[model samples]
Target: KLLSVGALTLDTILRVETLPVHQGKFIASDGLQIASGMATSAACAAHRLGAEVSLWASAGDDAVADQL
Candidate 1:
């Protein structure tokens, strides 16, 4: 068994057409949101190795926490 400990974060990634030279409102052509952390990665690896894995991260009560 493995106990993984680390942070859980909500990450946002945005893709734009071009770099901006000045301050202006821009549109994102694409975007992605992912919940990831070091502990999660380790837990996955352990599971792949046939080890029982557990995540011991704190996810406060909230909508985003549910996603995590």
Candidate 2:
């Protein structure tokens, strides 16, 4: 059996976007977000190896908790 804990860091990927400079604003050409966590990854890997897994994480107010 495997156990996991902690919240996954939700990422906001930006493509073809530049950092703001001198109050200049930049736009992202594309963006991709993923719901991933340390525990989740571990559990998934364990599951693939034919093992039972469990996760115990502290989630935020967003639906990320339920999603996990």
Please give the lDDT score at residue 2 for candidate 1.
88
- All candidates' TM-scores? 0.69, 0.55
Clashes of 2: 0
Show where candidate 1 strays beyond 4 Å: 45-51
lDDT of model number 2: 0.71
Candidate 2 versus the native: TM-score? Answer: 0.55
- lDDT minimum window of 10 residues, candidate 1: 35-44
Q: Which candidate is the best by TM-score?
A: 1
**Tens-place lDDT digits, model 2, residues 1-68:** 77777656665677865566567557788988766677767777788999988877666777755654
Across 1-68, the per-residue lDDT of candidate 1 in tens digits comes to: 88999877778889999988999999999999887778887888889989998888887899989887
After TM-score superposition, the amount by which residue 65's alpha carbon in candidate 1 deviates from its true location, in angstroms, is: 0.9
